[model samples]
Target chain A: EAGVTQFPSHSVIEKGQTVTLRCDPISGHDNLYWYRRVMGKEIKFLLHFVKESKQDESGMPNNRFLAERTGGTYSTLKVQPAELEDSGVYFCASSQVRIVSTEAFFGQGTRLTVV
Target chain B: TQLLEQSPQFLSIQEGENLTVYCNSSSVFSSLQWYRQEPGEGPVLLVTVVTGGEVKKLKRLTFQFGDARKDSSLHITAAQTGDTGLYLCAGALTGSARQLTFGSGTQLTVLP
Candidate 1:
């Protein structure tokens, strides 16, 4: 009955360094989503996974960002050689349905600061 | 790209006052949702309106979806200090139901 959970509530790293964020969705949830909110911007979708398969990743910012969901249990988002602009709050959400109308449980989020 | 615009980017009012926040978009959506986010936390779903012209209420909060399915509103009556938070509106487009287009958010602070 726990909500979605994310690791490293906060992170600070030098520019050009790599950081990985992890998300564990609620038990038995099949749909997991990644989102980011840059400074002064609204939260934007980064990608979505359905049972270990990426259903849509069109929102991924660039090749520098990589997201994987292995075994359909958890997800990881890696930003390699991150740029200063990559500093933002990354959020993870999960739901039992693929439709957007369904309620999605969200995590506390991981705030990444690229200095 | 589809974008949603929220009015009164910031709002501060004394407790017991009524306030309304609007979310407008040019594109139509299959559904629209409103959320409240606190510091250090992600957004929490407040309500979801799937049909045009639908209105739903939760306690002192009332949510309405536009007839065109391109706009929505949230109204809180007799607000309390606990009502203070960042209010966000997101829409799932008719074609791309997997992604949500979000508004910049309206920061509401209700002082007691």
Candidate 2:
């Protein structure tokens, strides 16, 4: 079985441009999550999806950030009109457990650079 | 502000040395987890401590949860170069959200 996979491991976009990050979770996993790590900061939670339904999205920064999980297998996070502060490493994770605090497998992460 | 506070944000030690990293918080969590991440890669779960005052050991790494479930610690014995990476601590509060609040992370560099 393959671990969680993220596409375009590295992305460089100009400020005000739009960038979409994708994540393909492990097969048979029901819980998928998105996180981001800014320079010199802790990795922060973005959102979570339980199948195709968004379980929680309180971590979303603003309306410019949109995350969708179509069919509950893959997830995409789109940053519209990206800003300089939006440059960071975006991570995707998945877990087999339906409950909280379980072991989660993470992807290599998409390093987004907005200059 | 970060819900979890990890001390010694960076540490450099020689191989065969022992070190202990700590994670603290004012808010009690239902469970806590420790993860390690190398360059260009995502974090990998090291261990999870659920019960307060519980202690679990994996190989040379020992994890301990606080008596009140508000803190945890990770101790590495005879550290190896392979252990060099970023160590992160996360806590999960009880509720349906199930989101894990992460710490700032400790970057450990073990030199041979």
Candidate 3:
């Protein structure tokens, strides 16, 4: 089976511009998660989705960031009027179960550079 | 503040050497996992320790969980160049198992 896949392996945009990153999880996986790692920081959780409904979004940085998973399939993360601090790598992950110890497969990640 | 603290944020050693990295936290976790990530790629799960004081070994790598479930360690024996990468430790807190708390990560360099 294919692992989680993320689009636009790298992205570069000007400050205040918009960018959308996409993620395609493994087939039949119901749990999807988003994470980001800024320069010299840990990879922080952003949000999670079980099917098309968001399970948790407490980790989302601010209002300028939005995420959606339609039809309980793929997911997208959009950042509007992006800031310099938003430059970092965004990662998507998936797992078949919701248990704490379940194995989660991760995507290569999208490197975003907000100039 | 970092919930999980990983010692020696960066490590460099010659091939055939042995090294051990540590991950510590004050909060208790139901489970803790270690992952290895290469440049431009996401982290890959190396091992997960659930039971306190449990120890698991894979090839030349050994993983140990603290007796309190609040810490973990990874020891690499006779390291190889292929072992070079970023090592990250993440945990699922007792109640909040849905989200994982990650450490800052240790960048390991094994020179051949």
Show where candidate 3 strays beyond 4 Å. Answer: A98-102
Candidate 3 chain B, run of 10 with poorest lDDT: B91-100
Q: Which candidate is the best by lDDT?
A: 3
Question: How much is the lDDT of residue A40 in candidate 2?
Answer: 91
- In the range B1-112, model 2's lDDT, one tens digit per residue, is 8789998999999999999999999999889999999899999989988899999999999999999999999999999999999999988875546677899999999999
**Model 1 off-target regions past 4 Å?**
A98-102
Weakest ten-residue segment in model 1 chain B by summed lDDT: B92-101
True contacts kept of 1: 0.65
Q: Model 2, stretches more than 4 Å misplaced? A: A98-101
Clashes by residue pair, model 1: none
lDDT (Cα, tens digit) per residue for candidate 1, span A24-83: 999999889999999988899999898999989999999999999999999999999899
lDDT of 3 by residue, B1-112 (tens): 8999998899999999999999999999888899999998999999888999999999999999999999999999999999999999998888774678899999999998
Q: Among these predicted structures, which one has the highest DockQ? A: 2
Q: Model 3 in CAPRI terms: which quality?
A: medium
Error of 1 at B21 (Å): 0.2
